[model samples]
Target: MRKLALSDEILLKVEKPARYIGNEVNSVMKDKEKVDIRFAMCFPDVYEIGMSHLGIQILYDMFNRREDVWCERVYSPWTDLDKIMREEKIPLFALESQDPIKEFDFLGITLQYEMCYTNILQILDLSQIPLFAKDRSEEDPIVIGGGPCAVNPEPIADFFDLFYVGEGETQYDALLEAYKENRRCGGSRKDFLQMAAKIEGIYVPQFYDAVYNEDGTLKSFVPNDPHAKEKIRRQVVVDMDKVSYPTKPVVPFIKVTQDRVVLEVMRGCIRGCRFCQAGMIYRPTREKNLETLKKYASEMLKSTGHEEISLSSLSSSDFSELKGIVTYLIDEFKGKGINISLPSLRIDAFSLDVMSKVQDIRKSSLTFAPEAGSQRMRNVINKGLTEEMILEGAGKAFEGGWNKVKLYFMLGLPTETEEDMKEIPRLADKVARRYYEIPKDKRNGKCQITFSTSFFIPKPFTPFQWAKMYTMDEYIHRAHVVNQEMKEQLNRKSLKYNWHEADVTVLEGVFARGDRRTSKVLLEAYRLGCLFDSWSEQFDNKKWMQAFENTGTDIAFYTMRERGKKELFPWDFIDAGVTKSFLYREWERAMRGEVTPNCREKCSACGAMCYEGGVCFEGKN
Candidate 1:
């Protein structure tokens, strides 16, 4: 019933005045009396960014499909906006109808990354909700989170009531309907979550008691409820074609990370790159047919009038009928001013055919992630792509008239030798030489070569599960070594060589594969003003270090130590469908400099098979 006053002098001066506007053309509106459940979908960032997210758009549209449930969008204010809200004493509120967030029955946050952890607490405090799960009562909004980061929700476990592990389409609505009926019968929050936890893919952290050894390793996690299952399966949509998704996406007033009509053509990836968390998490690729995709893309263009459309997936090039999809899109939208952007094209020069669609208009940098420098190191990570393939791809990218090329490699992969890293610059030099080889008459643009590299982090449930992470000092030292080697190898300084901050990258590794005790450090860091840790301006690594010190937990305890093959990991309880032996075997193969083929060629026997009830891919039947 309450609404934010637009005439308020303080509200006028804040950044992005559109963020506070409760009404948008495409947003759903519901009568207060009409809905049984009021759900607030929160993204731990400002509205400008949240409104641009495809996941939030999909979930918002999906939930609004239900007549009985009302879902609206909410986001954390940027520092400037937060200042005005705090000064004006404005509590964090939903965008539509300006309803105080506390009024919602459920607060669902998308934990996309670890950087959003502090922002989560900020939203809770401003909503007049208790920060800790144990401190909240039946009257408070039940806070929940879901995303890839939910795989290790322990760091922020005390803040959320439960975590939805995987795909949300089927289970979210199903859970909401049950909650509405139970609330009508006067059920408590505990009763609601306990009942919801019974649904597949729902993980209630409160209902489990976690026991850790003195060494900080997890002893066991015992379930409190009788119906609470040990294996919290990920929710999946078998027939994505039949699923109700948003054909009309919300068009942002400002440009974002992706300024295009976004389409998730597939659910999972077939390539089992050992270090990739997404490949492991979103297992068993399920795709929507070309007919459905064409329909959706056409509908989105008609509704939003967007200039570009991105066919997004782990590997868009790997789409079985990718050539057909792009050809059809270009044909149907001819002269409409809408172009296509492909995220993952094989770096092979053979890919120039796909690159020709919008190559002349879009002059962005080319990206190739060979992962490791040498073939042996590449095999150890099961990257599968050969050196010849990378060179061939780079040659094509340069020959295709792209001005800048980015070569992506990792510094501290398992079994990486100085000799292995020495090959990285050698490869970059070859790519650079290829760029200069173009004929003088054929060259239409200036040539530039950019090489970027990152530190490797060992992840849980992957082949690297038992591997030790590179120490911060070691990672930095090796990065310097790469730069030195590049100079000696190339004898030319035209190339731009860069690496990410080792401190932030190291912390990310600690959080990525950490367990329950890490929650203490996360909480302490948050309490000490550590939100938006992903942003360069807001992140204070020293503060995080202090938090770890305050908690008496060493970073090496999580990152640097190699676990025994038989040891129980904190996340070992949650099965992603892949068995433990499979991960261990992959680790063993990596140690022996062996490479495993992809799921498309051979089944690695990871547990994602449980999603489709057969092999993960739709046609695998």
Candidate 2:
């Protein structure tokens, strides 16, 4: 049994003591003396939330499979425990070993969202590790970051020793081996960084310097080290079926956000939504083999004993074997009281039928992400959804007995106008009207429409990366416009309108497009006690604004200013399989309100074909 870092008195006082105790089923535990490398895989969030992430589970399983590596899980201490840890001077420890993270060989933090930036610093601070990579001693672990947010890592680059620019399954094995070799050779931290930089996906930020123009635009991003590659090409797993997945994922003692068996049906997206970063970064969509998926699903269900299972994908409806897979799960677990959850599915006749069979029509609400209000706005964003299709789908769903509808949209997309903003409420009214069109005898109950709109943040690697972001006031004004329009509707009593926080949206925009200089702002924000910025109640916009003021960093330079056609971006050094020329063409098409077909419909030659596999060549001769 591993001795815990927290005392019995402290454990008794915390809200969820099980979070710090590591005896959870499926959690890997090894003798540290027998391993060459001790990796602390950290998710800078609370235990329940972190354990729910599939990426960490995959990587944790992969790392532990190696004989030389012992991987352990670490999550940010909850606010209650954080206060006690700071006061007690107790170092942050891994759940498996109950050992300080400062003693680990590698401290890998997944940059899943922009809001988790401050929490990264909190993790380092609690571990007794230096916040800045440069300030760390040789005894400190090599802190690295990966995940979707790493596509634009310049904002937090100063904190990480290196960043893995793409999928974890691609080059992680080689990275670990290289680290072991370097350590055996008695290499210095700088020497190891140089060695790591030579790898395809590894980016050592210390070897690169950013030059800014007088106007605050990126003048140049040049590599200072000869060993560092000028362009860090993102690594991708071409074959989704070949990668290692955790069949025996850790089952937490406490309930989590997602407490079901999660089957990753596919990776990447075929639809090239201009505002979506995941669509761009994760190019050339790949699907897992149906048989392989079925096997994993069976094994995972048996191993974890989860009562429910969810299909995860960018677009679940786009999967070619979706029906087969869904049918398999439904038939296999029909009488077992197992529930099937399908998210991100397109609303159509086929999907509606499948959903009606799997779920209770009266209790379940159908969801549709039209993304934009009007057809023209939808075309601009390449959502490939039109008003006719939306209304038709809604009518079919209503006929199928789903009276409650949930509509999702983005407020400040590129080329958005006042008319487009108002169309959101109008579209919801149309859905409600369609629901009421059903005969009273056939209807489940009163038609209910829940409308949600989140402010758009321009992200790197997307067509909208060069687009301007709205101010907090502008976003709130837009939301207010929609709210006012919603109030005037005949179904106002049945309609519920909700908008995301404009303040948090603006901060996310700043970090999304921010350069290396933005690191100082992040550091200052962390110093001012900015942690868990993603949590609405914990986020303090005033402290973040003060951090910007203290750092002398102009927030507008990263968020409000639109980029020139030929201007260099801080993230341009990375080639995310998709070429810049293709992104520019897509941006031009978005400006012209021209919709591009999805990869399955036609090959747009977006340069993701460089991978020579996936949907890029799925239908090609």
Candidate 3:
């Protein structure tokens, strides 16, 4: 049995002791002496949130499949455990092996969101690892980062030794083999980083230098080492079906955010929404084979015995084999009393019919992400959703006995006006009016429309990357406008309005488009007791503002300043399968309220077709 790093006294004091204990169901265990490479896969968040992520699970299973590599999971210690570890002088350890992360060969952290930046520092501090990559010794772990945030890694570049720029399924095998070879040769840290830089998707920030202009904009970004690629092309799995997926995922002791069998139906998205970073970064949609999905689903369900299964994808409706997959799942698992959760599905007659068959109408709410209030604004964002489509979809859903509808929208999108803001309430009111139009006996209950809006933050690689974000006060004011509009509607009693906190959105914007200089602000903020900024209660906007003030950096410079058409971005060093020229063209089109068809309808030739697979090449042979 492995000895736990935490004492009984310490475990008893923490909120969730199960989080610190190892040997959870389905968790991989290996003999330390047998494995050559000891990897600590870290998610810089609390256990409940981290364990729910599917990416870490997939990578953990993949790494451990190698007999020579022993991979373990680690998450940020909660405040209670963090205080205890500091007072007791205990180094943070991984869950599986109960060994300090500093002793591991690689400390791979997934950068999922900008809000978790402070938490990343907390993890390093507790692990007794150097906060900055440059100060680390040869004995230290090779700290690497990956995920969506890595596309714009400049803000936190000083902290990571290297970043995997794209899909882990494509490049991790090569990276691990290279690490083993470097170790076999007794190579130093510098030697390994140099070797790693030569790989297609690996980005060694130390080998690149960013020169700034007098206007505080990036003048040029160039490679310092000859071995380093000038532009790191993001790695992509051309054939996703060939990649290994975790059929028997680790079942956590405590309930997690997504405590169910998650079937990843596909990767990438067909809808080219101008404001969405995910749509841009994961381009030219790729899907799994229907037969493969059915097998994985059955295997995963049998392995984990999860009572529910959810289809994971950007848009579940966009999957070419969605109906076939859904039908198969229902037929296979319906008798077992298993629930099927389909998130991110378009609200259509077919979807409504599917939902009616799988879920209890009164208990489940139908969700639609129109993204904008009005058709013109939707066109501006290239959302491909119109008022007629939304109302018609809601009408069909109401006719199918779904009384509760959730409408999602974004405030402060490019070209948004007061008229656009008011249209949100107007649109919801129309849906409510349509529900009333139904015969009294036909309706199950009164229509309840839950209207929610989040402040839009321009992200790197998106068409709106150069667009300006709204100030905190402006976002709040926009929310108030919508709130008042909803109150004045005839169906005011049926409408419920809610908006996200404006302060966090502003900070998210700063980090989303921030450069290397933003690292200083991050360090200072962490020093001033800023961690778990994503959690509303733990967030302190004043402390973040002070950090910016102390560093002499203007937050507005990143969030509120609109960039020129030809301005070089801090993240230009990477080629994320999408072309800059294509992004700029889309941006111009967005300004003109011009809508672009999805990949299945008409190819925009966004340069992702360079991969020559997925939806881009679906019918072209």
Q: In every candidate, how many clashes are there?
A: 7, 0, 0
Please give the range of 10 consecutive residues that has the lowest summed lDDT in model 2.
612-621
> Each model's TM-score?
0.95, 0.98, 0.98
Residue-wise C-alpha lDDT for candidate 3, range 20-89, written one tens digit per residue: 9978878999999999899999999999999999999999989999999999999999989988998999
For residues 39-134, could you state the per-residue lDDT of candidate 2 as single tens digits? 999999999899999999999999999999999999999899999999989999999989999999999999999999999999999999999899
Model 1: weakest 10-residue lDDT segment is 612-621
Give candidate 3's whole-model lDDT: 0.91
Note the Cα lDDT for every prediction shown. Answer: 0.79, 0.91, 0.91
* Backbone-clash count (model 1): 7
Candidate 3 regions exceeding 4 Å error are: 610-621
TM-score of 2: 0.98
The TM-score, computed over Cα atoms with residue i paired to residue i, of candidate 3 is 0.98
List the candidate 2 regions with Cα displacement exceeding 4 Å. 610-621
Question: Which has the higher lDDT value, candidate number 2 or candidate number 3?
Answer: 3
In candidate 3, position 423 carries an lDDT of 94
